[model samples]
Target: MNKSARFRQSIDFIEEHLYEDIPLEQAAQAGYTSLMQLYRDFYTYTGHSVKEYIRKRRLSGALGLIKTSQLPLAEIAYSCGYSSQQALCKYVKSATRMTPLAYQKSETCYFFPRFDSETIRQVTVTSETIPRTIQLKFYYPKQRGIEHQAVAALRTLLPEYEGRIFGRDGEPREGLFCYELAVEYDPEVLNRLAGSLGQELTEVPEFCSTFAKTAVRSDESEIGLAWDYLYLKWLRTSMFVQDDGRYFEEYLCKGGEVKKLLLYLPVRKRMDYDKISVICCADSKFLVSSREGEQAEEEASAAVLKVLSRHHPELIRTAREWYVARNGMIYTCGVRLEQAIELPADSGAEVLLAAAGRYAVLESSSCSDREAFTALLDAWIQENGWSKEDLPAFTTYETGGQAEPDAITMRVWIRLKDVKNG
Candidate 1:
């Protein structure tokens, strides 16, 4: 097996024996690697020693049982590979600063999810340049129930059009988001068909910049997951940075069913250097939680938005979102506010100090990919010779930018250590 496969095998072995005594040598033997090499691999990839990984995994499993089941503490401890209930309590307190009983009553919990290698192989990203083409653009308001309208329009147009169709979810403009369906058609042919079609036909200029492209199923869930992995995981480690160009999808329809599409993201070579300003805030309020599962962050964000809409409607337009990730799992998500406001007792919000410090900020007109923006900001921090602080980072959406009227700018903030000087 290759390196990733070997590491995956070792991880599988460790996971299978998480509730049992897992020796470092046995885990290494499962992957046909030496114990020393296994230690290095775990640290390099997962940022945890093998022993630490096992311990955290055990704690995570035990905590799940603690919060959900009424099992006795001693039984829970033994089932999760703990020697006794006292040992489990000691580690839980050290990690979360809460006793098991107290933690069960708390609103938040820390969970370290398993590492899956299959995610790395799910989507393959390649670089390409798309030539200039003619496109039919469809504009729509940025509101609910617009997706069905767009899909209906595409269904009507796809049967008649014989060329390639591309879809783009454009940046917000005057409280509107454009959903353009482009087709490769001859100018003369489009001229005759433009009048019959209600939408505008525009000639897209040639794009010389390179783009990162990946193939994905056209289903909504798969597309969302692909984008999440791209922005949240891949971009942080990539050598290229996201460019200031629109991303789009090339649809592949068969038998009246759209099955797959090519997702394209504009990218450019990483600059040798870049600098950003730091914004400081005093305090903020948030509705926060550390949960598990693939949709945990999305669900938490939606809940925060719902509460804000009900209690603080005025702040909904410019609300900020934050997340906390440890050991490659994003375990926390919620809304953050810079302004101090008293929430009603039923608001379900908590106060979190927005510690005053220097931060690296990356502003983008497109708020669809906050994770990618944060990844770019992280790359900037590394390129500009700044160290990141152990603080929660966030992205704030500010409306009305200089670029356009009603334009929304997403500012990603990552706290930094003091600047190093020669």
Candidate 2:
């Protein structure tokens, strides 16, 4: 078999038998290769050692169950192939700073995005939320090109105010590239900077944000891609909408083998807008598990594993989770390509096509946090002056490339009807 097929086979085997005590030899056999070859290929493709990958996947699985299901911790641990609930707890606390019980009690979902590539930059993206902050911002026009001079002057004059630098292109003023160099404001520092450096204090209101840190020098050049990826891809589908506020990048440590940058964009959980984009989704096959109620369809999604074990063995490890809500009924599912061998024909599987119309799309995980979804909906409806139609909402999953686990992006679309006029 080709390299792609081998990797798929290996992943499929691992995912299939994740609940079982799978040996390396068994995984290799599933991939139709020697253990050594499987080891090398798995590492190359996933940037994770076979053992590490299995552990992380299992932990992720355990987390999902812990967060979404009524299942007991011991049951979750056993189902995720852990020796005991204590083992699961130890790993959970080690990886995330919270215990399983603590995590479950909290309103936050611990399902952060995962990275799967070795060549790409190794940057960690984490959610940053602060209630209220005030900053003194200094502006320099692009034409003057005095940003460095301004920064240098401020650094020299106030030496203690080593603030962050922010850049903006064509906003508030046309054809002007401006930098909003900011320092966490102290009345004393603000007074000193204004008197000495002559920069103004700009009010940056309370908001939630995201922060990215570049881990290695090799990952430095790729940091720009990470920034673009977050802004272009992540923000669109996220619960938060970009507010009319400051967006900036801060250099944490300069001229070091290990570099760090904190990119900040001011965001509100949602905004009201009556405008909607009419989208046309192609007809596709979905391996679905049916569910009731408005909760995230994680329980129903389990059906995907069963379908994979039977019908489309190739996609067992490869497909990302998906969801389709018809007439408000949720179906936890994943998309299947047409070329893949068709099975589940008699298994009550369904084909879905999202009807084209005006839709308000929120990009989130297939199994998204319920609170976040509710907040987004409330804010969106209020802001848009638009109300939902009778049509069903659908969540679509795109991995962006071939079968890479961490490449998933889930988008939920709510159909809107009739714009309210002011």
Candidate 3:
């Protein structure tokens, strides 16, 4: 069977035995894989370990029974695989900060539903980084036909200048709602435009740093459907929760007509992480050279580039390196390769394997403070109930078609600890 189908089979086994004791080995056997592989595949696919997934499903099932049936709490707990009513109560209270009786009396429910291959296939979600920008906001009161009024105002005002535009729905204040139309321009230019239009300009130093984005066509009559799908459907099933940042839409306008737009929903990790995604790297080879001491990274990179230029100059653009702290500092520089190649015996290079696995990734536009970036990622990993694997973490450098230092960016990838062992 295919990997996804086998993964679904394992999920089916979990659902079938949720109310019973399920041995980890048995669960792995259901998918025809070893326990370690099963753990890796489960976390990669569902963003949750098998044990955690089962615990959450049981909790959700118990909550459903409490709301609909008049069964005793002890019986409900027993059926949900909890040893005692007290144990179930403790779980509920820890997750929802409410006692079981209190939760039943109130209207609140904590539910983490089951996920299968079909559900994963249907849901489309992606992470995005929103750059810092300046904006001029226009607000409109909440009422029927306010959307039309906002659009008319935008059509009237857009002809004054040209730049990126965005729209957002704001919170209500004193029974009045707000619809903001944002234009990306310099503060000085936006100040002039605001003056001509008799509106005040608001300079936003930082936009939403991270967002969950989806594309939507402007031809859709009601954009509310997209929002509904994102919040009501996708949010409930995904490993992300809504963040405090404002949600907005980026308009792709042509001749004052919006042909399409991107809907950006501010989101943080449902768990302790910020914005986390999984990446699988293929097993590859790298031509590597290592150095140690102060300025080791720069010296190593320059040394590798010098070697590559003498031997294989065309591979410089594909350069990357790993930074490790040994006695003081150590940096290994190289170009990754998809296949093995013969090298000169005198060349100062060694072959290193970049092992294949699912890695948790974090990216930064600035590589100046790598320690700060790594510290943040390490805290996120531990807080989100994950451990770092005993693998070398690495950074990749990419150029933005410029030789300037500001044009280079870095991304960090660290392997996650195996769930079965963690």
Candidate 4:
């Protein structure tokens, strides 16, 4: 609902010098942004170019000046940052599609993001996206006697909850029990858990960990239709959903506090070409309503491909096709068999495969059914300044691969380069 600090800074400069010939160099210097970096950062967040923004602002101002002042058109143009009226009129027509005088005679003005209070939508501008440090961790199974003790231990950490812990009733799968721990993001919780576990738990074997900046989007929908859109953006573009990606939604003003819902996307993966897999899966219907899942599945691939075509469409120059498969929680992206471009053979692929980005990690709310989780993902998209353009092309895979659908976990993986960008 509001702009980021950088965008605000840009606007501050724009507002103060609207009538001046402010170039990209000046704005970048004022904000300490490199030219290329500034372009991507500004466009990604605001969805507009700096010059385009200035042009819009000028058009909006020119009409006001014409309406109320006796200033000459040339003077008005100069005051609005145009070096000459001819140049000004050309841009005005480019924007309004009519001469300035002609448009003024018709008493026209410019408006963007026109919407009512209830239906308001916001475009987010991110601060310079910097890498965050976090531990990439995995959880191994505990001994039989420790299972009960672990449950009791967890209760101490998350007490007063009515829901049953997964696998508490029956034998859970073996291996490490994946517990996401972060001292930086959740220092209090981490410190508390560490103290509670004490020296006795220090010997527990842990997985790997790393620090990286991840994308954090928040949405809530009865069906994960919106989440599908966000995924659509991710695949289509060279975007990253970092291991430590976080999500949170604000519900009210501080004094009149409102509910806040937050979720973290755990990632700290390396794109090892040798370990990377070109194929992965996701279940679309798991989060989205059956109808919505079907609708999203229909366009699932369109989502990711859009990004691929937009940025590295050249990747597709060899294999000009894409595909996605998902039923509820699982969605898979792969190339058509006929369009087999070179899959990586480097050691990096192996590393990538081991990392979270290597597989086709599909998200499902294991705690709830597909409908509930899908709806939740949708709400995230709306609140988090996300749109389909932000996600990858998505296609629903067929369901029931001889596995219990409910037991299926939510996972997705892509190459490190497919995601990690500033």
State the lDDT of candidate 2 residue by residue for 170-198, as single tens digits.
Answer: 23345444455555545676566655555
A best-first ranking of the candidates according to their TM-score comes to: 1, 3, 2, 4
Kindly indicate the candidate among 2 and 4 with the higher lDDT.
2
Which stretches in model 1 have alpha-carbon errors above 4 Å? 1-118, 121-127, 139-155, 158-160, 171-177, 272-422
Residue pairs with colliding backbones in model 1 are none
Q: Tens digits of per-residue lDDT for model 1 on 158-199?
A: 456655667776445676776766666576656654765435
Models, CA RMSD each: 16.4, 19.4, 20.5, 19.2
Which residue runs does candidate 3 get wrong by more than 4 Å? Answer: 1-112, 116-127, 137-152, 155-162, 171-177, 219-221, 271-422
Looking at model 2, residue 52 earns an lDDT score of 68
lDDT tens digits, residues 1-422, model 4?
A: 23355545655676678777777776765656676766655545434456655665676577557544679989988888788889878876766676877766652333322011110122233433222222222234654334335444555664543321221112234554543222122344345456454222222232333221122232235113433333333211212334443432112112222122122122332221111112323321111111134456445445445544654466445442234434454444433323223333331111101223322223432322333233433332332223322334233232233354434334222222333221
Report how far residue 224 has shifted in candidate 1, in Å. 1.6
TM-score of each: 0.43, 0.34, 0.38, 0.30
Query: RMSD, model 4, all Cα superposed?
Result: 19.2
- For TM-score, the strongest prediction is 1
lDDT of 3 by residue, 115-228 (tens): 743422222334554544445444556455554466567667556556776777655555666666666556555555666442545666544355656667774444677777
Candidate 2's TM-score: 0.34
